[model samples]
Target: MNTPDVAGATGYIDTNFKGKAEKAIQELNDGCDFVYIHFEAPDECGHRRETQNKIRSIELIDELVLPVVIEGLEKFVDYKIMILPDHPTPIKTATHASDAVPYVIYHKNAEIVSGIDSIDEESAKSTNNYVNFGPDIMKKFLGA
Candidate 1:
């Protein structure tokens, strides 16, 4: 709900949004089935006109925001946690290149026999067919 500009006084990569997300997760803890926090700081940073700032932003996310989010989510949620970027943003290009980003998912209940346990291109390719979004994911879950 509190979506802050990544480039504003409070950096987009700040824990402000993450705190909001955590609060939202807590608020919905009783009844909600799912939640999604799509922070666009990384994307914005990737497209920055300047090079150093972009790299710094990436480092900030990787160093500060990411660990906190992951740790906080794990503390709050009881089950699986999946971390996947829609695409990759190259540092050199300072732009989002059409490249498959890394994907990793941690499931608490079931052992991960396949899919993105580790971040490798070959592994992603291997499990691409098995993983789909929305209705497909639901179908897969329900054995439909």
Candidate 2:
């Protein structure tokens, strides 16, 4: 519900990413049980075939966003974080691909045994864990 106009050179980092992270942290501090933060820069860069920008966007998410969010989540005793893309947008094709996207579920209190250290398509597929239907992932993520 807090969509900002991210339509310029620095829009990816300033508005779409850092701003979204700040808003999510605010919502968490406000006692919201669930907060969904989405960054559109990587997808947008892929669509535009800006390969370097796409890499930079992902880097910004890791450097500028995730650390802040993790710090915010540390204030709580228990929390879960799910990170994933809705679909693949290949820079070469500049279009959406049907390939299954990668996802990672991190439970603060659980001791996960999965050896997957990276959250990328290859690592996800290597685990052979997949939700055949995309919508079903929500139910699984929520433990419903």
Candidate 3:
């Protein structure tokens, strides 16, 4: 059997954000110019009846996954990290939302002091670090 070079992958099991973080670092090791890590738990939680799961999922992503991925990326060169949801999933409705969702863009060279400790809707809005360019955001980030 051939071992996959990428990480965060398994068969017949639930996907975890930790795997996504591992895969991202592995991709960076494999000389990838860019890496994309996806987490499904929040959406899954939103689909369920419990609201705590959704909150916990987001917390895990922010506290656990973010630090791991960021620390791994720090080994190479500075990077611009952008975290955003495709759309809002209101736990109240337990459904998908088509409305605009807030995103956070942390430029590697940008100053991070100014009372900025985390990246979320409020922090993103207050810092003016939003990515609303849709699909073009990636291209623009890559200078394409």
Candidate 4:
């Protein structure tokens, strides 16, 4: 898929990306055990140097994806869901910073972890902050 220019040069956010996200979520609901989706619309908006687009993307996730995806998973009564970004690209720099992105994961049997506010401390101990430690974290979650 061609990435749309989020700047005024394009003037409009393409709707296909979100539509595809919806479809994929639906398909996963049919049979897949897990689904991992990444849409860079927010990152693209940031690259365009606007938080407004990022905010809009966030709202779309809240309004569209969350309800559909979560409701689908909840139906199984044994599924888990995790949502987070790998890293955030700053609007001003339009570049990915080596900063940690907030991450979260859940399993039907896993207790909800609370009060672990920031990834900063965990990231500081690692080589790349903001770089994903998702696989490692996932392994642990599955093992539990």
Best by lDDT: 2
For 1-144, candidate 1 gives per-residue lDDT tens digits of 443243233535443554645554554554554545565666666666555665565566566556655665565535555555555666568777766554555556564565345555567777664454433444444342
RMSD of each: 5.2, 2.8, 4.2, 6.3
Weakest lDDT window of 10 consecutive positions for candidate 1: 2-11
Q: What's model 3's TM-score?
A: 0.74
lDDT of 3 by residue, 90-138 (tens): 7888898775566656667663555677655676567664456578777
Give me the overall lDDT of model 2: 0.81
Per-candidate clashes come to: 1, 0, 1, 2
User: lDDT (CA) for every model shown?
Assistant: 0.55, 0.81, 0.68, 0.61
lDDT of 1: 0.55
Worst lDDT 10-window in candidate 3: 4-13
Clash count (model 2, backbone only): 0
TM-score of 4: 0.68
Model 3, position 122: C-alpha lDDT score: 70
Error of 1 at 6 (Å): 13
Worst 10 residues of 4 by lDDT: 2-11
Q: Which stretches of candidate 2 lie above 4 Å from their native place?
A: 1-16
Candidate 2 structure quality by residue, lDDT tens digits, 12-130: 53445666777778887876778887777888899999999899889989987898888888989988888998899999999999899899888888848799888999999999998
TM-score of each: 0.56, 0.88, 0.74, 0.68
